[model samples]
Target: MTSVSRYMSYRGYQFPMLKYWSPSLGVTMLGVVGAILFLAMTLGPKPYYWPTDASYGSSPPIATRAGWMALALLPFVLGLSVKANMISVLTSIPHEKLQIFHHWTSYAMFLLALIHTFPFIIYHIDKGDMVKQWKTSLVYWTGIGAIIPQAYLTIMSLPFIRNRFYEFFKATHMIAAVVFIVFFFLHCDFRLSSWDYFIASGIIYFLCLSFSQVRTYLMHGIHTATLELLPSGLARVSVPTVIKWTPGQHVFVRFLTPDLHLLTAHPFTISSVYRDPDQAGKAPELAFYIKPRRGVTARLAALAAKQTGITKKILIEGPYGGVSTHHMSQFDTILVIAGGSGGGFSLAMVDEALRVSGLHTGEDESGQESRRRLQVVFSTRDTPMADWYIDEIESRLSQSTTLPGSDNGFETSVSVHITSKPDLTRSTSTLDSEKGTAGKLPPTDITTTGSFSLNIYRNARPDIPGLVARTVAMAHANPMPNGKKQRIGVLVCGPASMLHDTRNAAALAQKRTFGGEIEELYLHSESFA
Candidate 1:
């Protein structure tokens, strides 16, 4: 296999385990090219994808321009595919292929875009007519905006940042991308390429995103929700979606307007469910904690703020992420590490863990029978979001007493690390005691023998050395309740920093136990930022 092939097959995105039929990137590209080619052949000449001098506009100049332009577009398209294809699905294409294309092609695209624009600019400059310049003006600036961010996103998509300083890159990429795509569409005027195809591309991506949303909404619901605030700026809204979702599974949501019919959806794992305290049914109602930020969410917030009720519908799709939750019941104890609204996710699993076999104690409290230890280390800088979270925590705490399995009950500990704002200095100092939790819960010295974790850079993301050491410590200190060696699964969702650290920690832990082979493994990673 070629180096490019290797990169595509393995080095790109972290493929989440799922059972959906997703097409391979190679297949998708081939199909797209086929569509483009057929159109070009049918149309004959101008704007044709492939070339021949006399018949089609495949002159060396157009060919070079098109080829380079395609390359420049590679990063944006590839990067988008990578983001959209976050779940490790059953695709003819493995997750890595497009990433490779996205990475390498991005450079080619950047240079090609420059080629396409500069020559046109230079030729136009000689005429120097203000009216003529204004005519071609709109898309140039917009396309440039799109290109600049696409270029930066491509640079950071490298494994170094993609896997290492992922938090910053992820946030940067998402923010840049939303802005870029908006500009991208406007910049073109849909004149050069087949307008239908360009529109089709928008539809293609939107379809994937919309399908996920509609599915999720139908399954989850968009009405009657009580928003509770947790301690860490985490807001948990429990709505009754008639849909039943599996544990360790997730879905996409879009709560906009007629735009929801066109725009992409935001992804989130269901944090709490009411269907199966035992998780016995195929369907269930759920609760989700949302960390309000820019992008899709900010708009959702604006809509909510203006709303008189829960009429804003969110499109939801997928019973995606076939993450194994069996160990949840089998482990001696389950340790969950969550940040901000991520704590809501813990509540979902934690409620179930209390009832699962090994994790539960023999004694039945109030005759319901339950005993499971779930520790949530929640940290937040005092903000309006934090206020929202505190309200949720109080409500959940009040409701926890009634959750079937929680009769004997699990203790819900809220760790509020507040300072001025996003300052890592004084805040990190206060949070220092939370050192040895799964992804920084609390030091084992302050906690018990059942579980422990390591902190994920409360300041700047932990460097590689710090991460390696943290992974080592967590590996060595893995709590194996009842003194038995067992498989410990990890499901992390929050900032990209925690995901990276958790992934590395999980990997090393597996290696520490079995000779470098992942055993009984299930990892589900999602980034809210």
Candidate 2:
């Protein structure tokens, strides 16, 4: 199918506002040029290129222009690749979006690198000294070395090859990065106009690396990870560290063991909020619900299944990437859709919303109206995984009584959908009352508390578009407590298909004005891969 048709089909309706905010090829190209101009302005235009003699148009001014442009863009490329990018931090743009800019900027730099190289060679050839320069100039050789590795790295970065051979790709990518920097510096040889860019890039990269190393050492030096293997290829890795993290954030973990090496650090969502009991000045604890995909995860799962008692050292990198603060408290209705192990992130979002709701009491003409309604829809192939999450939901709800007037708290609902074959004895065949369709369904309302409920269904997957539509309608039905318009936030962390469906559904919902009340829908997607 065509990409537009697939997008429209998933969207269910067109939403110009959401569509316009997406990244564009044209915009990226413009940004590339803008960035170059911004840097060039800093370097003050002079006679950037001057010929040694009158013939051949004074040595092709491109030699100097191209060299300076390449230098100016180097810092941007380096900074964007780092997790704690200064530009991203300052601009409040998510690192993921910065990564898109990073990719395009790299392409621009590659073009500049070509421009920087061939023009110098051609200018020298026009002077009839190309072979002599090549034979004697260390700068020439170093530039050649830098360009060759960079070109090789760029070619190997093709999606098919990178995904298929990730380990080799990672190793070579790092090596090539180091090689590029070393030769790039030597080739420039402290040229005054461009030295600042190289120095800035080096400083930024050094700080990022140093901070990561120091943070890992301080956080995990005294920590321990206890792994419990769960049903359906899920393993729970629990680490006692005292660092607090926002909901939906993730960390890179390196497990040091005979089976697992330091080279295998992988990112995983912190499935739960940090719990700090304030006991003996210890740090907060965190847990990860890991699915063994391949490589490091598979090896770790196997080791955990064996139940060895030896203490294993670990390194924890960060609590990186989270939902923006602007999107956190404004939403009146929050829908979290997760598939399989992606529940790790969704459940934490649910917990955060509930916690926030308890802290803030929304008051209006009608006193004390609960402003947040949180819905969790988790789909998995195995009943056991669903059962585990069901238990977690009940446990969290029971703990909510600690809040003042705790009996009446936020409105939270959970739905666990088992899409594969089901246990016939436990699940009764019923029709979906909301959809008015006949299907093999479980009880619509399996369990309920004062304002919390858990629904379980069998032999079906969630209709992403239908659920989003119904929820938006319900949210719009209630007027906002203050004069503000009602807002809905849809967050999905799952397989690509689930993320796509949830995103498109959100895009469609955001377009509706809801009688000029501006019922807004925003979608946040988290993918561990």
Candidate with top TM-score is 2
- Cα lDDT tens digits, model 1, 1-529, are 2323322221122344631222333444655675466335333445423332354331235444553345334334633464335233445333333454455455455555554555445444544653576565675577677778777776777665565655456446768867766666676565555355456556656765665455555545554444454444344555556666655566655544663333555567777644553555554566676776655444445545554244554555554552345666554334455555665665566555544443455544344433333434444444444344434443444444454453434433443332233432322222221223231222221322212221222222223324333433443454333433334444555654455455555444444444432123334455554
Q: Which residue runs of candidate 2 sit more than 4 Å off their true CA positions?
A: 1-59, 119-133, 219-222, 279-283, 308-311, 324-329, 361-365, 382-384, 398-408, 421-451, 457-459, 480-484, 513-515, 518-520
Candidate 2 lDDT over residue span 26-66, tens digit each? 34456668777745653456544465654545334666677
* Superposition TM-score, candidate 1 onto the true structure: 0.50
Strongest candidate by lDDT: 2
Determine which window of 10 residues in candidate 2 has minimal summed lDDT.
431-440
RMSD of 1: 11.5
Question: What's model 2's overall lDDT?
Answer: 0.71
